[model samples]
Target: MLSLTKVCAGYGGFQALFEVSVEVEAGEAVAVIGPNGAGKTTLLRVISKLIGATSGEIRMQGASLARVPAHEVVSRGIAHVPENRRLFPRLTVEENLRMGAFPRAARKRYAERLEFVYGLFPRLEER
Candidate 1:
């Protein structure tokens, strides 16, 4: 589970998020919906440690992530896919999927995960 408390983040002096708080329970799906420049992406970036929180705190499974680095976020069981898919257009579908499984934990179960995903969307395998 992930929790954000009174998170305030911004670029320079322009505040994008102010006292924003959110919680995501295990096995639950949450969506961030808003208009352009609504700080949705900023919220995610802060959560993923791609950006830092100016105030408040973030916790995962009750552990504080105040000083966790961006590269270590995935190892902490947090994976972030930006709004931009950022897929390698020159690569094949399988290649792209493989590219996504770069984390050590995911790499160990690459085949299994690939099969599970392909089962969910057969078109991926066909592509």
Candidate 2:
């Protein structure tokens, strides 16, 4: 589970979130809805560490993520997909997926995970 309390994040002089709080319990589903530029993506970015919370605390399973970096966020079991498809134009589709699976500690299970991904995209399996 992940929890965010009064998260305040923004750039330079502009602000996005204002004392925003959120919670995602394990095996639970949640959805965020808002108008254009309502900090929807920013909320995700903050939790994933892609963007820092100007003020607030983010916790997962009782551990604090105040100092965690962006790339390591995924290793903590949190995956972040930006608003746009962040694909590497120079990399093949397969290579792109590989990049998505970057946790070195997960290498031994890569084959099974690859199969699971392929199951979701049969065309990828064909490739």
Candidate 3:
């Protein structure tokens, strides 16, 4: 589970998010829909620690992420797949997916994770 309470962040003096609060319970699907410049991306960036929140608290499974580095975010079961293409053009789809399991902890459960991924997007596995 993930929780964001009164999170506020911005670049320089431009405050993008103001007291944004969100809670994602286990197995819950929460959609963040907003127009451009609506701070949707900023909220995610703050949660992933890509950018620091000027104010607020972010917790994952009751563990505070105030001091957690961005690189360690994934180890906490929080992955931020940016909305951009960073794939290996020569690699197969499955191979590309496998690249995501590069971390030692993730690699240990590659097959299981792959199954879960494919279950969510069966077309990817078929291709």
Clashes of each: 0, 0, 0
**Residue 50 error, candidate 1, Å:** 1.2
Question: What's the residue-level lDDT of 76 in candidate 3?
Answer: 74
Write the residue-wise lDDT of candidate 1 on 1-127 in tens digits.
Answer: 8999999999999999999988899989898999999999899899989889999999999999998998898887776776477646688989978876877888999999899999999999999
- Write one digit per residue (lDDT tens) for candidate 3, span 28-112: 9899999999999999899889999999999999899999999999787776776666646788999988877877888999999
lDDT of the candidates, in the order given: 0.89, 0.84, 0.90
Better of 2 and 3 by TM-score: 3
Error of 2 at 36 (Å): 2.1
Cα miss at 80, model 3 (Å)?
A: 2.1
Candidate 2 yields a Cα-based lDDT of 0.84
Better of 1 and 2 by TM-score: 1
What is the alpha-carbon lDDT of model 3 when measured against the actual structure?
0.90
Error of 3 at 71 (Å): 0.8
